[model samples]
Target chain A: MQGMIWLLGFLIGASPDSVAQQIMWRVYNRPSFQDMHAQITMTLIDPNGTQRVRKMETWSKKDPKTGETKMLIKFMEPADLRGTAFLIYQHKDREDDMWFYLPALRKTKRLAASGKSGAFMGSDFSNYDIGGGEYEDWNYRLLREEDLDGIPCWVIEALPKSPDVEKKSGYSKEIRWVNKENDLVVRTDHYDRSEMLYKRTVVKDAVQIQGIWFERVIEATDLDSGHRTVMEFTDIRVNQGLPDDLFSIRALGR
Target chain B: MAISWLMVLLAYTHLGGYLRFESFVRVDSGYQIHKLATTLQLRTTLDQPGISGFSALNLIMDRRAPDPVIFRPIELYLTFHRGPVDLTLGKKILTWGAGVFVSPSDFVNPWDFSVLYSDLEEFREGIEVADFAYYRGNAFVELAFLPMFRPNTYPLPSLQIPVPAGPDTFVVFMDGTHPVLPEPTLKKGEGFLRVGGTWGPMDFRLLAFRGFDRDPDLQVRYVWLPGSNPQEHPPDTIHLRPEYRPVWMGAGTLTWIVGPWELHADVAYVRTEDTDGTLPTVKNPYVYGAFGFFRSFWNDQWSLGLDLLVKRIFAFGQTPEDPMGVNALLEEQARMLNFQYEETQPSLAFHLQGSDTRDLWRWSASGIYDLRAREGFLLATLSYAWADGVSLQVGGLFSGRKGRSPFSQMGRHLGQVGFLEARWSF
Candidate 1:
């Protein structure tokens, strides 16, 4: 009876783990290209348990086939932080051109990738951190199928090939838990300097738009420091009426 | 020195009549400072006082570097970039300390191409010194020669203390006794030597220095107390015991980085022999100070730093009533009190600012207090730097220390300072 039941399961091809893996690949590697303008708030928790918050407006666009992306970030707050900008054009083959504009200094400094491993907005994120809402910066491979809370999910493992790549990637290998139902990443584990699980992020409150699942609430917690940050999204509009000039340097002056 | 000046003059003469003029004026009306100063400077590098502030007018006609010049090899006279070592020649200065209140290298008396703080004293009293450097990632080393010089002496109105005048109506006093450092890497001239080297994160500096050679020009004044101003009367017996190699001075610094914080400290110690030249001190003087600062970036446009500097200067002293003829001044309340002028300055300093730039759009405010001297100073500067490396900066410094010796005296001061400069590079 057990052998017959196993054969029946194999013939059905409806295993929960296989379903999660399929969903994860379909969701993360969705379309060829997508662009969005977002207001990002990053909160940094130091080893001493002190918290600092910073806000920036960013416009990011990525192309997976050509492995290219462009980012424009502008700071808005605390008066002194206004008028500062960062423009990055990324290419997969080698280095990316990074430019930082200092309002007070009235100058733009070109930064190299070797400096990416440093702090970002006083946060733990390295300048070279691989996220940046892109798919090409990291080589993603479906590692395993796992279940969380009786829900099937797919786990992915990524390894950076070069030292520069590693510096930009805060993880040697990050595991993403994608829900089988909607092809959305539900949770992620970020490692630490010792290659131990140091932090985790949980994404919830998902809403499907244009046949895609997007989460509105993202929470990241530091395991060692007992500190965490909660980021919520609003004005959740996708592909609304955003002018081309809105992303141009000319608009910054006006 | 002669060749460099003549080279600058020849270049200016070739320019003919195309001389540019620029001036910057900064006005601040906040935090109890409501003063104004306008700096107008011109460049020709001519062999004369091309730029001068003739009491009322500030004529600046520098012959070396004027505005709007594209070719600036003059600014890059001697360039040395061998391996990890870099050096520069043709009018450049080296500064060792990071103190905003006081810089020990100010005694070197020269201008530096520093990214910050360029308001320097008269360069005419500055001598030529060799600049050196070495660097290999984490380990770095540097050695420099600081030349001491005497400035041109001018005549001033005589006071009621009866200062004897020379054959003419002027009482000029410019010392030309010894030549300053005649050789590179060797203490060529002078009775003392200043040689030091910095290794790794450590800064070790020792200066064999000398003091006071009977100028007979310092006029005496009454030392004033808070409530009264009085006439200064020197003790009947006095001494001007000139001592050679009378002191050995040194300082140390350690800097390390962790996360976003740069932990740094500046520690200095100076031990000098008990001399009769300065004040009423009866024992050797020693001074030491250590400080640290952390850089905090609020956002891309905003960054702030917090620093705490602890300093102490001690010297043996006689009883309070002992008087000195060294320097005397009138008091504010018109009453005199006899006391030893020797003192120690120990204080805490705090500096907060949004950003630092050569553009007038960027601003900064700074304040400091000297504990033992019971005095304080405040400074503010606004600057602007345009595209193409052209910039303008204007700032002022207010220094006030109370009179301690019976012959020492000073009152509150109200003054203004500003500067307007422009530079172009390829």
Candidate 2:
């Protein structure tokens, strides 16, 4: 439906910037299942090629009643962090709410959601990347049409709408590669506050589960440090009708 | 124990934990092995149809320890959950307050202050409780009953007092022994009720407790010879008997996540037996409060936190002799018995930590300053993670004080020590 609106706007001779935002809106509001459960393996590789592995299980549900997305992630590997869980609630019009639970402490700690620019579990992916950035926080402009590996793509350049947003994001600009066919952002180039290339993320694989597209493999690398993090998703289950109780603090401890 | 028997009978479905080796040397003097220890921790779980059981076992091997080889169970509990109600039984670790380091409302279990800045798990022991909870949406009401009282464990140093009978004063040493445990009766048991919920970016907890103070109250007893001047010939034996007394407490905690900062506050009001400050041996009623905030900077590469704790005693030095004046004898008694330096005591702590972009190498420093006591402690550590399961840390704990305070005594005993630790989790 969002794609149809973008097409209609394009046919009505909308401005290039508005057209770019329309395209981004389609990408942000792409069709997906109601809920999902998956197992993820994250590999961190240093500049010298040394690799460390971590594993986790995640469950995410989009609440239809409130239009909020709730996610729970539990670390399953690297025994020190085993039984550690995080509960996140992403609201539509406000900052997210996060709860972190440690088995050793047997306590749940609530964290401020404004630290979205921080690394996620020491991985190259920031919390903002994991939670998906808000569409209205940036000004989008259509850079140009490009073809990568014989696939048509629209490169959209996004600049923070305000200095506060830029400071919170720790980024000067981000250029995203949106697949023209599926409205999926397959690649992104992140720039530091000085407008230097800081990180690059590319989707290695995308699979369809129950007629819903899912990115199965992603690799994010720090351009400056030569450190890389590769994430692989397995055992993906969609539309499992996950219960609301699974996202509560009680389940976080369990 | 019964839990050991149950552990042997149940089939282990899952197992996890860590092994740690640590060594500390006194750097203030000729190098000496201050502490050398190896610890092994194991946690196992059994998930069945209607109930799930969990147990954690800890084993420590330290040549300097009293027993040398110590083994204990950290947590052994079973849980039953159905719909909105949940029940738990046996020994379990429960954190009831919002404060990170110093929680005025967190008295669910006795703390082991010996490892306050070292081992995270051994800093406190699990309490045996029967817990019941009812939850709906973002709110919960919990009720817990602890059938016995457990006192905090910390190193106790003898205090030297100068007693004056005439124009001269003689020094007398008073030492404290282990605290007397409360009787295991239904009336002597502890109970707690907590109601908490979250609203928007804030959460609050109200707690009511009927229990004994974890910190002991001293009962001073001295043997004095007849016709002996205390100034010239002080008492040969001054025994400090530590006893736990019942107290009524009400506490509340609030946490607000605003912008990039997380703010938390905890306040507790304890009503002791000595409501008035007439008795020098008994501890007077006091209010304990802590406020703190944590914020990250430089895209979360560096984080800083500050916590301030204040304690105020009511009717601090009101005695029959001196109605308005703060009595020196009462102050001395409080210092010797309770380690309280002033009527209104305040301490501030700051923690700062940062890491490299890869997060492979990290450094953190934390310090606490007791303003009234003029005492301070600092701990700084540099750590490296070699692998996902392996890590190494080098740190030092230092204390400084101007006068006779708890930190001063601890500093005198421990000196300045540097430590190296390696850990492997599997």
| CAPRI quality of model 1 | incorrect
Query: After superposing candidate 1, which stretches have Cα over 4 Å from the reference?
Result: A1-254, B1-77, B80-90, B100-127, B132-247, B271-284, B305-311, B319-343, B355-360, B383-426
What TM-score does each model's chain B reach against the true chain B? 0.51, 0.87
lDDT of candidate 2 at residue B346, scale 0 to 100: 92
TM-score, prediction 2: 0.90
CA deviation > 4 Å runs, candidate 2: A1-12, B1-12, B46-50, B157-175, B220-239, B321-334, B401-409
Docking quality category of candidate 2 according to DockQ thresholds = medium
Interface RMSD of each: 15.7, 1.7
Candidate 1 chain B: worst 10 consecutive residues by lDDT?
B48-57
TM-score of each: 0.42, 0.90
Worst 10 residues of 2 chain B by lDDT: B322-331
Model 1 lDDT per residue over B1-426, tens place: 999998865654312111223332222223332222223322222212212110111233433333322331111124355554544343332333434334332233322211122233222212343445554432345555534333222111222232222321212222223312123323432222334332322333443333211011222223333443233333222222211222345555443434444445555554544443244322334554646554445222343344454544364342233243233222111111212223444555555554431112556656556555666555566655443224455565444535331111221222222444443311
